[model samples]
Target: MDVLDFDLSDREFWAKPMVERRDAFDRLRARDTPAFFAEPVVDFAPQGPGYYALVKHADILEASRNPEVFSSGSGGATNIIDMPGEFAEYFGSMINMDDPRHARLRRIVSRAFTPKMIKQFEADVNTAAAKIVDDLLDAGPGCDFVAQVAARLPLKIICDMMGIAERDYQFVYDRSNVILGGFDPEYTGGDVSQVVPRLLNAGAELQQLVQDLASYRAEHPTNDLTSSLVNANIDGERLTLQELGSFFILLVVAGNETTRNAISYGLRLLTNNPDQRALWLEDIEGRAPGAVEEIVRLGSPVNFMRRKVTRDFEMNGHLYREEEKVVMFYWAANRDRSVFEDPDRFDITRSPNPHVGFGGPGPHFCLGAHLARREITVMFRELLRRVPGIEGGKPDRLYSSFINGIKRLECTF
Candidate 1:
């Protein structure tokens, strides 16, 4: 048997076009149940353990569903070596937890997004969508869609929800961009050695800002989600100060990054597949939902998540021992030939699209999924209605393996 060294964390590997990466994963999946690889050491982080890249749809789903065997709490989700205890604890959200701890954090956080909050958020999303379209209209044609359009609605909505001031929106936006895409020169710049330190610094800045906001909210409560979070408790349980910081970091990075990338990809994908774009434009109301799902499926932002095996397990006659790291390649699973018919085709009406664009079938499934979907649907509907002639040029992609992001995408209307 030939050993395929598949490194999920390799930046250069991820920089390859989606078609190329998909083909590589397909070949790996055929050969190895879970292909073993020496995990790429990111920045100066020491290589901790070699991992098996979970390439198959079923295997990724199995790991996600059975958190007991594939536990996130055992370590942080990043494929890199261990972070300092304090930093790891402060950065890992409920996504990096299991069982009672995960349940506890999730329950408390759920209170922040009550029905009333969600209803208000939907209304806000619609308003933001309209404003975004209006801005595009005013700016005329040939703008970087990622900057002028796709990135706006979600970031604005998240900032508004968190009660961040308009001035701070840019601050949060810059830091979030750096936090996720710091490895990319478009965001970080300068020496490669400075990237990780700069990312850490940006993270620290975000944590401090959130902490200050949380502190103020705790004292002078308001209707914002930040206030709700600061004051929220469920079953006599509440998030500790550190937990709040971690959750805020997760929300800032995950909330803004995923939706923006999805929207950016949606435009690019639609541009590439005009037939499907026309299909969506014909019935915006009926097709928007499916289109959003398909966009997310194809985008597959947050490429992979790592889990530490707690006990020995067997899948496809391959043994996974305790203490082993397994990187569930969500990107690969999303394109699994066994799952979606015509997996590569970006169809607007892809029904029964069970894409794990959001962390497969698991307890740690994206909390802001409903809101993200709403934002995408509303934004695209507005765009298609107002700027039906909008066409996307080639995208300058983000240079990280973890996030499938378009840093800049030029478009003309």
Candidate 2:
């Protein structure tokens, strides 16, 4: 096989180990290159500030904890088009931003994800999960768990929240499939130069819906997040059409994709770790919550987060020029040997869990954390209760290396 061919197929062909760091990353650092990131031997310094991969727990923690030093403003390690500049202009959601500005936008969105708002979402989530599970249960014996349960459940929940119609759910699903189709085996494929425009068009459709919802809120206000966002005042300024558009897109992306990955990964983890799965099944109360955290921490869906270095600074004895990019390695950091004991083992009973499965500290802590935690917790609770004999078949992982996730997983229950 060609050198490139060997790199892609064999995860263990790296310098250290596949989980520890990629060979490309080590080579860069060995040559004293400023930054490093993972690859299957695909070596092209990513667009954004220069970075050295932060694999150790302390390093990831320090970087994530200190936004001013490890600023998200610099917009690191991304593709040509998806940088924060384009994202802010095109969509303007808070995830693509740094603090001060990020804080203001986050607060506006945070109002809707509060304790009460999440509690209200439960009835809807339970209702959605129950119905989907009922259908899958009848289908019986063997099927793609991702399609039947994990993928469909969150897709339905988000659609309901957006107030989209029954038929439109499939449309929403298809668009999201394309967006996430960047990873896994593609249902459809093309050049990113072309596909990005298509993704943007999909984003535009979402924006238009937000605009309509905003207009609706202006005329007749209600309790929906869209309505709340439409009516929100930011420093005596209402959110612009693009802002609303961005927020809704963030909602759908964050809402559907991460949850889907977590659930799918959770099932796969459990199926493989039969001992861990038994612990969950045996301990009804405590282990259930613990299992959710364990699966999510192990899964760590948002693999690498990009940050734009706002100003020049020195760290660990090296100087970085202003606007240099930094990439936080979530996958490596989650399994950081320093923080997590027996990091590779899938122990469901793990506690004092300090994994940064969610993004790191500062103003950028995920807004939907409570909602996400509850959703994952409940999803697992219901899933294990029903799919008694669930076992591994095959995991159809996503095609994108960035948004590492499973798109389809075959399971036998």
State which candidate has the highest lDDT.
1
Clashing residue pairs in candidate 1 are none
Clashes per candidate (backbone, < 3 Å)? 0, 18
lDDT of 2 by residue, 128-199 (tens): 877877888898867888788887777777767766667777777777666656523353354434555665
Relative to the true structure, candidate 1 reaches a TM of 0.95
Off by over 4 Å in 1: 1-6, 114-116
Supply the global lDDT for candidate 2.
Answer: 0.67
Lowest summed lDDT window (length 10), candidate 2: 1-10
Estimate every model's Cα lDDT from 0 to 1. Answer: 0.83, 0.67
TM-score of each: 0.95, 0.85
